[model samples]
Target: MIRQATPADLQTLAQLHSQCFAESWSAQEFARLLAIPGTFALLADTDAGFVLVRVAADEAEILSVGVRPERRQQGLGRALMAAAAERAFGHGAQTLFLEVSANNAPARTLYGALGFAEAGRRKAYYNEGGRKADALTLKARLPLGKSA
Candidate 1:
């Protein structure tokens, strides 16, 4: 299950993000982003995960998506993404976009399962443990459906 996240979820979201990523977004950053128009956040039940997205014109982009380390591989990430797509579609978005670290095979598989295809790449976009990693930009038409 998923629910719309509010201001009260900032700390939880930041915590989960920190646990899931090498570099984390502070609660302050999440607060600032949430204040922007067309931005939205969704929290998975029990704070297992969350996805942040922004819609503009005919497109929506996943600003961030994270699942607690222990909760990964349980379909929580997929659920959060599916919910984000549904919300974005309702708001007039025709396509969804997100960027994933090229080295992250698990995430690449997840996005591919959701019908996302690589659209572009940013060289050395992420610095993890002092190593640079490329960021692959992916795109998918909404609303997201089950993978074959």
Candidate 2:
């Protein structure tokens, strides 16, 4: 089931993130984000996936998203993205943005399928082991509606 996340879900979010990324964020970091005025998160419990987002004025930024490695390719990511976008729009966001490593084909594909388009790029944005990777900035226009 998908549900809005509270600060109490930080540890679980951190654990799930660790399984998906080489550099995982800590519970403390998650707490800090949660404390931010415009930030929110959504968790898919059974699917072991979560998405963090922050909305300010008419814009929303997706801070992070992850799914347990074993849980990927099962629509968990898509569900999380939909939830986050809906919530952000409800919070007054007209546009949603996110950054993905340029080399992350799967994630890029998913974002593309969700209607996110490339908006910009950041050079040497991710550090993988001793190597660096560029980041692609993507943005999508959110449907006009209240939060579901």
Please name the candidate that would achieve the greatest TM-score relative to the true structure.
1
C-alpha lDDT values of all predictions: 0.92, 0.88
Q: Which stretches of candidate 1 lie over 4 Å from their true place?
A: 146-148
lDDT of 2: 0.88
Enumerate clash totals for all models, in the order shown: 0, 0
Residues 109-131 of candidate 2: C-alpha lDDT, one tens digit per residue: 99988888899999998997878
Per-residue error (Å), model 2, residue 110: 0.2
Report the error of model 1 at residue 98, Å. Answer: 0.6
* Residue lDDT tens for model 1, 1-148: 8999999999998998899887789999999999989999999979999999999988999999989988888999999999999999999998899999999999899998889999999999999889999999999988776332
* TM-score of candidate 1 versus the correct structure, residues matched by position: 0.94
lDDT of 1 at 20: 87
* Alpha carbon lDDT at 2, candidate 1: 96
